[model samples]
Target: MNDSSSGRTRDPSPAAEDPDLVRARAGDDAAFGRLVAPLRRELHVHCYRMLGSVHDADDALQEALLRAWRGVGRHTGRGSLRSWLYAIATRTCLDAATTRRRRALPVDLGPASDRVPPDGVARTEVAWLGPYPDIAITTGPLGPHARYEQREAVELAFVAALQHLPGNQRAALLLFDVLGYSVAEIAAMMDTSTTSVNSALARARRMVAERVPPATQQQTLREIGDDRLRRLVTAFAAAFERRDVDALVALLAEDVTWSMPPLAQWYAGLDAVADFATEVPLGSCPSWRSLPTSANGQPAVAFYLGEDRTGTHHGWSVTVLTLRGDRVAGITSFVGEDHFVRFALPVSVGGETAVGRCS
Candidate 1:
């Protein structure tokens, strides 16, 4: 089967050979693992786009794999194994969406706040959008008619906009645009008519366009080149460490935005963001040390805050930067020390070092 995102035909899994298939069908765990292993990472990413949380995606993909494994015996081999697996994963995500609320950012809830609130924003009860650890993502259109690259679909802006869409609309859009599924195929997967699928796609496209920026992060990163990208990320991290608000401001676009998830407030524009820097992160928050990392396929810094007299530091937040041309256009800082656990980051730092060993 042709991978929609690439021109070359995808190699059939070694397990798809008759002998291996038979073994898997007969309930050999090792055979089954080989049968599905090739597709697991991509399928997990699909689940993430569908459901919007790493934990949720992990759970949904596991359930989908279980369902696929239990039902492997029924396969007639009329279709590509990849398509069949995707159908199951899509169904799994749809089920989860029906039961749980959509994930979102603070910006989705209300207008941008000029500065941080006195007590800080509430972190409990809200289903805030979580950052994705750096993972391989397919770039370029899935097919001749596709819209978003696999990685672009997961960018903070794109993902946030998607959360506002109704579940079915979101699914149809991802399958058709990101994964390059045909209209009829999507209808069949979603158990709807072709006409209905078309309508969903139309609405989903419009809503996403309305919410997302004109240029994607992927496009911007490519334009900037790798060496420059590294320098840019490092500069931001250095500025944060020094609490140099002006230096930070110098790197921002005229209308840059900064939002801290779980915090209802966000800052927009150079002046407002600078005000925020002076009063909040720079002024109120404790000492910081940041390590360069990537999240959602974009440059990010995981920050550690010094919390005690002994100079101990703990995971503070993961700040993902969004750029436009040569300047930073947006910053979404996902707060909460607990978040470090998800990224395999150290929970707390000490012993004459701190957040990822003093970096």
Candidate 2:
């Protein structure tokens, strides 16, 4: 559980000379960069998990670095530099969370067709769910000393579920349980008693567990390769282009669930979801296209539709599909133009299409 195995090691003695640190503390830019470089990616991930949004993580990380640079001269070497940075980052995140409410997807809001606030209203005002970088998954295996255990725990569902907990509770649980910080360490980081940290952790865990459904046994749909995933995307495009509800339904599981966040409504079962699709505005919008992408450790499609006048394509939802065997278990569509760029999806589907605008 030491720092080296955890991927948080500092430079060896001569390389990490006291004089170099002293110079860095006195405002040497190159020396300071060396000190901060090792911790950047891990700190970003930590902030993402704590804030539940990539954008927020970026902000918090910058703030933490600035704070560290400004205060570096006061470094008494009382503790590990990694821990110290984490303490600063954790406080920054807590401050941000305290000012803003938590974010949730449709499932967290409630059942299907529930009366909810308008999109970009109170829901967005409360923290909105955010995207994560795929590189976080491809990183090498974590050691026993790694701060965060179970990287999948930062998946979209898990993060969306986290929005249900109060801010302090979320911070405490992430610091103690996910990050493997000692209870006393968490207390020190949050400036609370050890007993309070324990209580917050218990409450946060219970709340998150209650909100998120247990992971069911299903086919592993994550990173199945580009070719196979493109097939699914192609199938989806053809079905939607033809406005063929039956064809689309064929791709879904019997118990398939569909949801769109911010609106706070969801549909369960094939028939119910089919009815919603066929009856909604989706029925009218034809000439659909989907580009392949990944999110929440699952295969996903970023959708676009052809513009009638310019023949250009416009943005649509990024749908993360859960597969049971070969059938689709769930389809969660994250809609909005902003989400398209944030998730690094294309503005349009790239291919020639014979299908014209459907009447």
Candidate 3:
């Protein structure tokens, strides 16, 4: 088989090697690479959601790929190749999760004073989940698979909230809920009983509900195209950069929610969100810059600000904006420098002051 885009012939056909499927079954690395390479990006996204951290997902993906390559020869071809890879990837995530506690954002913790304490409280260790590369999620021609249809599950809030569950529970939930795996299949992959799988899934659901707010079940936001989201985000950037709280308020939904993670307190409603921005230190900062990015399949901004006499660009936060209709419904500000590189975001905005008005 060969990938036409890359122009690389990977592995010869099993039938070509052996009509009985004996030779190709006897350890062909080329065949194994061919089988898994096409699915790497999706598998990485899966691992990211399961682990709730991009760094962890990357590690788990590498491990899963290695395991799949080594074990591909043992395949009897009774199951779909995608399903088998998922089994391996899920197991790898479970193992990793078992070794580490679930990560939380600072917003998950209660808010402290905006002023830096002299003692300097250590930042919360909540698993600061990173955004997946847009190319990974949007790339390639998608088939009619259920996995392709459930792209929203990969969003930042969804993935970050997932970290609250225990590893096994996370695995069970994703397998059953997102991947639509059968109970018996999940049990086999988990090496546990069906009852246990059910229990894990239940716990996972409760945890997800508690951490990630219930999104509107209506399909209004799901159909939002990239262009529309970009326009809304640009408007937001322009309003904030120009210190036009009125315009900002106009763009927000009546019940918009504004949260800065690692700090659990959130402001709700357009009035409250507007007040928080205009009254808070974030609003008072003299110069602000925002670059467009996507997290969890939603529009986001990587924020930066001018600092002191040094002209250095101080890292501020990532705002993951959730849209409802043409308005902003939620804003999650993930603060700090550690998350920037992981998201593959630039340190500073290139030019212009406003959102759509970028030069």
Candidate 4:
């Protein structure tokens, strides 16, 4: 099998010599499964990038694989199976994108609140951009020429920016830039002219550049190094567990912003965020238990809220921190019990020896 970064054009059916390919084309279901297994993980990532939700990616990938299986005989062995599968997956996501609402974060809904309100209402009408469990994300770029690493491509900023794009532009940008497909190859895969592909790519690049950060979280993390980065994340979770507002504030950058999806209100600037932190997680919430984790290639904390009489701490939010240098620059707390399962975290932390604990 060719590496994902391998260029598009090659000898027809490089895998044609494999018996499995012959069996798959000739209608062996097990053979088809063997052919698809290796490419499945990356394909799922591609779908997630396109749809901006893990649930949506799951649905799209299932449909794409089924379609590929049904059309296996017609594959003609003219291109690599991986590229063929990606084309199916990309189109599947596009079709889903047309009918579904685009995912968003709280910041997208309105201007930042200057101070904390008594409470913020959950906006169920908005489809929030959910976090990806970085454990499942591959570490490197899909291709050598790909601009974004696999983890960087899934960073909150990058995926959130993708949600703003129109379907064609989104597909073009992901295919050409993130997946490193040549314009001519993308044109063929997308069933469009090379000129059309180039135009779409140009437009997509401009819009994405406007929203995604100049420095990705991946680059920042590399500079921080593992030991210091781990300590910074540990300190962050500890502050919340101890309800130490001062410690938490100290970890934040001067212009730090805090946002929680499902909550339409967001806090920006040090004072505004500190005010909200002082009022909410540090105040209104009686107690918090935290477990250090990672998401979107950034350090994160999985919080469990107020314990029951039985001493079970219920799951709360997966808070992902975006670092600028060694300080926390942005905090995105994806608040919902539903998020925990994706990270393989239990819904409640019983009286266990988890990393961060306070009462």
Candidate 5:
């Protein structure tokens, strides 16, 4: 293996990840960029899973790339490029986690509110989990040893569970089980003994198993079938457009929960959710346009609202729906127009009906 800092060429074999390794090692910025392009999205998502914030993932990934670029010459390619990048990313997140509080949801704070909190959510007191753009999360087996499916790993339930573990345990668990790195490889990544890595993995698995539900959203969606799923999301969107409370309630579970982030106020049970709908959102007399989409590996819809249906309905929020059986079990509405950028969703819905995956 060659160590660039030593001004040596000990890399006798072609263990390099790319054929252009020579150029990348010689400080050709474009070559390095080209070399890492294919892995960027996956790497970013990996950071998001570690830190639980889209914004923090952006910063961590940027820093990791900078570090990786300067040190690329030392990557003698003894292992896969993917694992190397992941090692850098995971360490970067571990560093960030020490400074910031573990990301959280309103449920983690207290019992559900019977009514929307009047004082409003204080952002400083809460570190809400930001939604990840679906574009960055791909579906398929990440590697032979991976346990969770790509989408299943990103679900809100799974990400929330990861937050409870210590930073090292979190990194060890994600690297070994979710990303498919072996115990020996994870030991190297975390700079710990293989026995220590196994210990962390065992503790992490126990905690995550206790918190995560028996059934994942991906499995639920699979059983629903694509056509039925589309029709269901489309119908929910239509009901919102019409503000038909009865139709909306019909799709909800009797114990449905509705939460709006940045507000810290969540409603539980059918009656409470229906009351909030009648008194707040639906009662506001705003016309809505919803485009169905997917988030956190579950069904979602993006809303745009306006005084009338003529020009454009400005971006409102993205609602992710959780299901139990065939009914919506919970609704998490991440409010604010700021969420549009990640989805490549327009700030406003114009002439045509709002378009996306139809969830």
Candidate 6:
């Protein structure tokens, strides 16, 4: 079997020779841990893409792993253990999705606001899309025939588009197009027929094609190259620190968009985005500082806001930048202190000591 985690083939007779699988089958919990430790990160990424929220993915992956442990005795060893686990995980995510509403971005709910509302409130009741820390994603595609690189699969646009799909369609698309599974394999994993899987895939393709951009951020970054991309994000962070709205606006594309999830308002076009940048982040906010970070495989920054008396900067948001050619085309600032924890960022930045960049 191929170890998708390492991109290498495993010993063909591992089901018979591997002691971890043998012990796991005999109900040794430690043995089961050893057997699954290698696949955890990638599986979590899969869950995140399927569910659209890291918290939901954490719950679903835990539930699926428990299910796998409980049912390990049923494994026939006819297929790779990776495939079996994925089948269980996908089913678990589907069940969870059925009971909950699909995650969404503010733009998905309505038309973009031309001007900021006087009292724009965070919609706590809505299950908004959450950002994924790039630390969780590995660099390459999971399989030989996979269409999207692993990073591209978890890109914000792709994951957001997945939320627009039905559970079955989403599963079929991810398993087939992203993970490089065969139609027959997906059908069996999904407990459906090849005809059904094909139908789901076709519908999913059309919907995602309509929503996702023509260029993935991974492709754009590669075109920009590392040196230039580094300089770009550095300049972005500096602009916020200096509170220079003109410097920030110079980094955006003409069709740029700025949206903060949980907040019901989003601004589109260069004019509106610049206005929001001027009014909210630059003009109204107290003190601003930022550290470069990556999210959903895109260049991002961890913004901090300092209160008047505290003299300390608190974590504000993880703003992921979507680039078009040389300029930012989209800015999705996921505002919340909880997000800082997920990215292993400090909740507070003290005076004079500079924060380091997160890769």
What are the TM-scores, per candidate, against the unseen true structure?
0.90, 0.79, 0.75, 0.92, 0.90, 0.93
Q: Candidate 1 — worst ten consecutive residues by lDDT sum?
A: 1-10
Give the higher-TM-score candidate: 2 or 3: 2
Q: Which ten residues in a row have the lowest lDDT in candidate 2?
A: 114-123
Cα lDDT tens digits, model 5, 1-359, are 01112222111234665666668889899988887887888888889999888899999999999989989989887676677788999998999999998998777878888765444544667888878878778642244456777788899889989999999999988886776777888899889999999999999989999988888888888899898888888888888888888888989999998877777778899999988887666766467888888788888999887766664677878898898778999898887788888888888876544422110
- Tell how far residue 231 is off in model 2, in angstroms: 5.3
Q: Model 1 lDDT vs. the true structure?
A: 0.80
Model 3, total clashes: 15
Instruction: Give the range where candidate 4 is weakest over 10 consecutive residues by summed lDDT.
Output: 1-10
Off by over 4 Å in 5: 1-14, 118-125, 139-141, 350-359
* Candidate 4 local lDDT, 1-359, one digit each (tens): 11345543331344556778789888899999998897788898889999999999999999999999999888877687878888899889989999999999988888999777766888899999999998878742354546666677888999999999998899998887777777777888889998998898889889888998888888898899999999999999989888899999999999999998888889989999888888878877767878988887788999998643236678889999999999999999998889999999888876643332221
Model 3 ranges off by over 4 Å: 1-30, 111-124, 138-148, 206-218, 222-228, 261-272, 279-283, 307-316, 336-345, 351-359
Candidate 2: misplaced stretches above 4 Å?
A: 1-20, 114-126, 136-150, 216-219, 222-234, 308-310, 324-326, 349-359
Give the runs in model 1 whose Cα sits over 4 Å from its true position.
1-17, 136-145, 308-310, 350-359
For each candidate, what is the lDDT?
0.80, 0.68, 0.67, 0.84, 0.80, 0.86
Give the lDDT of residue 235 in candidate 4. Answer: 94
lDDT by residue (tens digit), candidate 3, 1-359? 01122332222223333323343356766656666777798788888888877788889999998887777677676665677788899999888887876766555555533432223233465545555655467333322212323465676666766776778887887776666677788898888999999899888878877765555312435566667766788988877667788888888899887767655556766666776777653455666667877766677787777643235445577777777788888788776666677677775554434322111
Best by TM-score: 6
Which candidate achieves the best lDDT against the true structure? 6
Per-residue CA lDDT of candidate 1, range 1-359, in tens? 11235562332433345676788899897888987887888888888888888889999999999999999998766666777888899999999999988898877778887555666746678788888877444442254445676778788888888889888899999888887778888888888999999999999999998998888898899999999999999999988888899889999999999988877778888898998888877776667778887888789999877743247677778899999988999999988876787777786666464433211
Q: For residue 325, give model 2's deviation from the true position in Å.
A: 4.7
In angstroms, give how far residue 94 of model 6 lies from its true place: 0.2
Superposed Cα deviation of residue 30, candidate 1 (Å) = 2.3
Number of clashing pairs per prediction, in order? 3, 0, 15, 1, 0, 0
